[model samples]
Target: MYINGAWEPAESGATFAVTNPATGEKLADVPDGGRAETVRAIDAAHAAFRGWAGLTAYQRSEFLYRAWTLMLERKEHLAQTMTREQGKPIRAARNEVQYGADFLLWYAEEAKRVYGETIPAPRGDQRFIVLRQPVGVVGAVTPWNYPVSMLTRKIAPALAAGCTIVLKPAEATPMCAIEMFKVLHDAGIPKGVVNLVTANDPAPIGEEFLSNRKIRKLTFTGSTEVGKMFARGAADQMKRVSLELGGHAPFLVFDDADPVHAAKGAAMVKMLNTGQACISPNRMFVQRSVVEPFLDELVSRVTRMRAGNGMEDGVAVGPLVDDGAIEKVDRQVKDAVAKGAKLLCGGHRLMDNGLDRGTFYAPTVLADVRPDMLIYREETFGPVAPVIAFDKEEEALEMANDTHYGLASYVYTQNLARGMRIFEGLDFGIVGINDINPTAAAAPFGGSKQSGLGREGGHEGIGEYLETKLGGFSV
Candidate 1:
């Protein structure tokens, strides 16, 4: 981990193995950072906050631009490392690197545009001005699914807002975070402005972050359960928090939409990161009038998807992150199948053609999934698509909004009026009509309800690390 501008090991000299999920091989050992290391990182960030916050936005942007350039320069190597560690397909890994770089580039330019407001006071001799200031040291926790993009999504905006950060990357995939720190270091970022602590047991570190007063803000991306815990912990200190947590996205295929094209889009969304992404479509609802044709097209598309090691060429789907993920996916499939859902193609693990050694699940398609089934309500964070049929628009809307999660939802329809109606009716924060990919650096990415709190991108992202102060001046 990098701390106080130097590469260092854990104070206790403890290290843990980082494994390649695709091969079940140990890649390297990273520091097993704990409470003590977290404190060190926090203190360092707090000490460096003044200097970093004092720098002009233009100056900060220059450093961010340098880091962005370095990321692009090392794109291929970074992507390869991500594929080896995070288990996404090589092409997807490359796209993640590019996506991560885009955040840095976008924030680099956005830093100079943080605007304040001035208002006339009620009194004749007074003026009111609202100023945005950095929110002190930030404690960031990122997940492993989209390793590079998740880290950049948190750090880029925090840095652009003139806040220092002590980040804890997921233990399963720390190599990308380490590599990103190298880019920041080489970009001439001031010492202690950014710090990293990698730990398998993150509870102790999280405790410190929640209780520490110097760490004014907490930003996290992970499960909703964990996000709730963080929210409760931060409540005592009244710490500002921004959470981008779990999602059970719904993909709706209307009767008017082309079943073949909609099926292809749904398959693409569900297969991303082997369905590990929080925003990946989970519960797919199709109108009964076209459910059969849609299922046929969907099964065909899923069957054509090649599952193998990420390093292999032409492999669209890769292994799940680990054994635990595989088990969870298997359990859900079995439960769904036993409860009357028809398994169209796959519902088992793939152990053939060099995939026996790794954690791989075949892309599965399930039809006639009922509301009572576990797969219908829970997040199947694997390549298993459980679909249900709805006859009316009201029924489809009711089924889509049935979950506790409100992260994202998709509606595929040829009719503009129907699309607009569903788009407005869906309870999710992000709605896609005919578009499967809804993520971008320029858009506000977040959800309502248990999906998350606050946003992570666009102008709202920078605001997550900023505090507003109103000043009344006598003129």
Candidate 2:
């Protein structure tokens, strides 16, 4: 663990094993830190907050820029580290590394652009001004999936906004966080300004983050269930909280669009990170007239995808995170098939051909899926795409917006008017009109309803770590 700008083990000497999901190999034994460790880290961050936040934005920007350059220089090494722990394809890992590094570069520039405002007062002698200041010590928890990007997304903005932070990365992928901190430390971030804690269990660490008074803000990227718990816990302290939670995104395919092209796009997005991402389209809604053709094309592509160890060449899909994820996905597929949904292709676990050592599931596609099935309601979180046929535009739109999750929704329509209408109608934080990849360092990435609170990217990201102070000055 990296805490107080130094590498240290848990005082209790307890450690937990980190294994490669692809090979089930023991990678390393990380410190199994708990509440005591968390408190120490929190205190360290609190002690360093004032000094870190007092630095000029330009001075802070230089540190971030240096970190950004180091990240690019070590991009390949970081990508390999991510794939080894997280079970994502090497190419995808590289892309994520590049994407994650961009946050540092972006926030570096944004540090200088944290603009304040002056408003006209009713009285001539009085002036009203609003200043954006750092929110003080922050506590963050990131998930296992997209390990590289999630940390950079949270840490970059906090530091750029002049806030000190204590982060507890997902136990499954702490190596990525460790490597990232090395870059930050080498870039000359001061002691106690940033801290890291790794643990086998999250409950104890989370308790400290929630209950600690010194932590003025909390940011988390994980499930809605845990996010809700954090929200309720933080209510007592009224600590500033930002959550990027679960998503069950829907992809709409209208009859006017080319079924083949739409199928290609859907396959790519659905299979990204083996469909582990929050923005992966959960339900694919196709206009009835083009439903058959789309399914045919989609099934063909899914079958053609090669699944193996992420480090190997020509491997597009890799192992699932663990056995639990495999079971959940398999259960969903079974329930959907039992509920009368037609399984087109690839519906079982890939345990043959030396794949039995790791948790691997075949990319699956189901058609004629009804809302009564489990796959229709819950997030599949795997490479299983359920196709629901719709006749009218209103029906498709209604089905798209039916979910409580409102993170990302996709619409494919050649008609400009119809695309615009669907874009407006879908109640999601991000709408991709004829686009599968809608996220970037410069764009706001978050959800609307149960998906999450506050944005993660763009200028709004830095705002999460800042508090607004309004002053009435009289001269």
* Candidate number of the best lDDT: 2
Quote each prediction's TM-score. Answer: 0.99, 0.99
Q: How accurate locally, in lDDT, is each candidate?
A: 0.92, 0.94
lDDT of 2: 0.94
User: Which portions of model 2 show Cα errors greater than 4 Å?
Assistant: none
**C-alpha RMSD of each candidate structure in angstroms:** 0.8, 0.7
Task: Give candidate 1's error at residue 226 in angstroms.
Answer: 0.6
Model 1, poorest ten-residue lDDT window?
18-27
On residues 1-475, what C-alpha lDDT tens digit does candidate 1 reach at each position? 8889999998889999998877888899999989988898999999999999999999999999999999999999999999999889999999999999999999999999999999978999999999999999999999999999999999899999999999999988999899989999999999999999999898998999998899999999999999999999999999999999889999999899999899989999999899999999999999998998899998999999999889989999988988899999999999988999999988998998878888999999999899888888888899999999989999999989999999999999999999999999999999999999888999999999999999988988899989999999998
The number of clashing residue pairs in model 1 is 0
